[model samples]
Target: MAISDFFCPQTTSIVAKRERRKEARPGELLNAALDLFVEKGFAATRVEEVAARAGVSKGTLFLYFPSKEELFKAVVRENISGRFKAWNDEFEAFEGNTCEMLCYCMNSWWERVGATKTSGITKLMMSEAKNFPELAAFYQHEVVLPGQSLIRRILQRGMDRGEFRPLDLDYAVYSVVAPMIFLMLSRHAVGACVPAHVELDPKKYIATQLSTILYGLRLSPGDMEPSQEIPQA
Candidate 1:
């Protein structure tokens, strides 16, 4: 009998079980390594300890990740790239005003990062970038560039629709994005003690930032006005 025609329930079940195990194994190793790295700092965490935490042999960990550096890269890819992919998927079907859509996407992206356990890990990666050129390059290429591209596309659409003024697209895109990056990084310096009254709410903060940019770029005088009726005092 042909191999394709010989499909049996027992064989299929064994193949499915093996596939699940293979997928789970790498994820378990990565999570264990990430936890140790976050807890002990990357330089202090050893591979053997990661293997022990993952309940796998050191050889098996090495089989999946050839080196410590490679494993760290995997951790970054898992935490950072995966988040961006989720954001991209969430907004893939988005159709709205260019400025509003950009703000929505940016706000959602920040919210997701804020919710993740790996936010501290991302902070570590940013702080250690000077010492880790490969990681820095990977982060810029994979995360920053894609984000910039999205921003640029939004600005291009606005400019095309004459919704925004004819400014240098590159500069306008950067202006919109750079402030958000600064605000996100500012959290590390500001600490959790930001007073409740003054604490930066991500959604409102993003809306204000995007509004400021739109104010500068918006083409129509009426577009600058609030879109709601004010109650008569």
Candidate 2:
């Protein structure tokens, strides 16, 4: 409820638009926070700097986010939560074969979460989890569990259809995610000074990992034959 909205009925529409813009400031601030958090680890990012990047006063930032951890949680929610919901929504209506669904889901996952700078958050969590247990727990409940559940559902679907062998769902989920997790860690833990020959490339790594995963999951001879190569990652 902005002051302008209370003052006049005649200009109510204009005031409503102004209020909406004011409401949008928090999201803009969160986006700024995300960029800074990615560039500098969470512990190093200052609230004043986030406020400056967001074009708002430090007071305004506090009005929206009471603490730095709260702001970080907001950034995490913005980057992962909404996308997860949308991913599940799209997945619910997906009509592909189980194997195709696996590839489709991974490709979507990589594009939506992996390709973006936001993906760095996963590595951040891994590094900070011991020191920031509550934050790690929040992420576990909010993002990781939901994501693993989605994979579990897909694996169950394959088993039900006899497209895949019975699998230990927990281990299978780790198998699916390990490569992407490794890549995220490698980007941070493996410094930029590494030789070109030793540097890891995500496209190839993801491709090889997926191919191997599908190979083991396939129940039929033709199922193992890839319809298409992973496009020369």
Candidate 3:
């Protein structure tokens, strides 16, 4: 074998590795940015910190993100907003009844977002959005509105199928969202201050909330199914 052939393959391998690394830079930066944004909040996190965490220079970060605001937007898109299309598709393809679908939706959200560090994005936005109006609007447009729409669709599915009674959807969506926001807040912020003796089980909490939403707090003698009975404290 010619010595040139061995050397040529090695050279090609090195070039391929470099190209792969270049392709991965944007994702690395986004992951690093998410970590910092979640830990430090948006205002406190610096662009240089994100680049350094990603093992890249500030200029390289700019090559992809252009500006800090844009970088943050990209991070939000990658972590949160990007999943909406797949979620919507899941809704379309779901085989379960609306009640089961609602349960699946909330559980899926917990698995995907609540159980992950990505949930901190919600905490970050809640704390910092008041100070950054532009980013707040962007978040509203990108995450909040779509999220509400998705929830409305879920509720509407229930109503249309007769699983749920007619509701004032404008207000009902907020009711559905309230517990989720509490869970996020509890996970990211409020849970920190919670007493160590008190165990906060998100899965159990979600189950309880779903039951309340579906069955209501009021129990008529005839209304309670044995399976749907709320366990007494």
Q: All candidates' lDDT scores?
A: 0.74, 0.84, 0.88
Q: In model 1, which range of ten residues has the least summed lDDT? A: 188-197
| TM-scores for every candidate against the unseen true structure | 0.71, 0.81, 0.89
Candidate RMSDs in order = 8.0, 7.5, 5.5
Clashes of each: 0, 0, 0
For candidate 2, write residues 71-155 as lDDT tens digits: 9999988889767778888778989989889888887778778878888898888777898888989999888999999999999
lDDT, residue 67, candidate 2: 96
Cα lDDT tens digits, model 1, 1-233, are: 77766778678899999888778989999999888877676667799999999988999999999988889889878877666666656555667877777777677667766444455565566667788788778878877777777777777878887777666766777897676665655564455435435677767777788788778777886543445555799
lDDT of 3 at 203: 94
Best by lDDT: 3
Higher-lDDT candidate of 2 and 3? 3
Question: What C-alpha lDDT, on a 0 to 100 scale, does residue 44 get in candidate 1?
Answer: 78
Q: What lDDT score is found at residue 29 in candidate 1? A: 94
lDDT of 3: 0.88
Query: With candidate 3 superimposed using the best TM-score fit, by how many Å does residue 59's alpha carbon deviate from the native?
Result: 0.9
Which stretches in model 1 have alpha-carbon errors above 4 Å? 1-22, 36-41, 82-92, 186-198, 221-233
lDDT, residue 212, candidate 2: 98
